[model samples]
Target: MTLKEIVDKLGATVGLGADKLDREEEYCFASDLMSDVLTLKDTPVLVTGLCNVQTIRTCDMANLEVVIFVRGKRPTEDMVELADENDMILICTPYSMFKTCGILYGAGMKPLY
Candidate 1:
């Protein structure tokens, strides 16, 4: 599914990279553990509740293109700048991590496993 669709489904706000909302994403992995994030092979779209600069850094390192911040958490300005610099997309939703994952999964987003 497209990032646009995911955002719509999750009622998320685009904190950055709004122009790239049409980007297609077939897989996703939700986790708060940065170490686990690094272990993924494809680095699928990251659905995380960890809203920090390090989250952006980890995704950049892993080549994950998108991050969905759950529970309405917003990234700091520093995090936004870093993600923008890396051309990464950041999305925020008011739902819990579990709901975020479920909505995305129900929308046909595949899991890494």
Candidate 2:
């Protein structure tokens, strides 16, 4: 799914990098554990409930771009700045991780498996 579609479908708040909305994400990975996230390939969209600088750092280390912060958890200013520096896309959704994953999956977004 496209970033714009995910945002619209999930009714997410685009916390950062609206300019990067045109990018397409083929796979989705839901995990609060940064260690698990490190194993992802294809720069899959991260569906997470954890919002912190470490989240941004994990994304950076994994070379991922798009992130969906579930349950309305948003990144801090410093995290946003770091993401901006890394050219990452940030989104916050009010839905739980399961709901968000279901929504995106129903929208034709594939799994990271």
Candidate 3:
């Protein structure tokens, strides 16, 4: 699904880079640890509870097109700026990590590897 679709389906808020919402997402990964995310061989739509500038940096290294912050964790001002600079789409969801991943997976979003 596209980032726009994920946001619409999940009732998520576009925290930043709404223009990039059209980017397509093939998979979703839910994790709080950057280290675990880094280990993923395939790039996926990252769903995380951690909200910080580091998330943007990790997205950069991972080449992640979309990031969904679950449980309503808002990104910082710096994080928004970093996401813009990195050309990443940021989203905020009210759902917890488990529910968010489950919903996406149930909707046929598989992990890329």
Q: Estimate every model's Cα lDDT from 0 to 1.
A: 0.92, 0.90, 0.86
RMSD of each: 0.7, 0.9, 1.3
TM-scores of the models, in the order given: 0.97, 0.96, 0.92
The C-alpha stretches of model 2 lying farther than 4 A from their native spots are: none
TM-score, candidate 1, is 0.97
Tell me how many clashing residue pairs each candidate has. 0, 0, 0
Candidate structures ordered by lDDT, highest first: 1, 2, 3
lDDT for residue 10 in candidate 1, whole number 0-100: 91
**Pick by lDDT: 1 or 2, better one:** 1
Best by TM-score: 1
Alpha-carbon shift of residue 72 in model 3 (angstroms): 0.5
What is the clash count of model 1?
Answer: 0
lDDT of 3: 0.86
Q: Which candidate, 1 or 2, would have the higher TM-score against the true structure?
A: 1
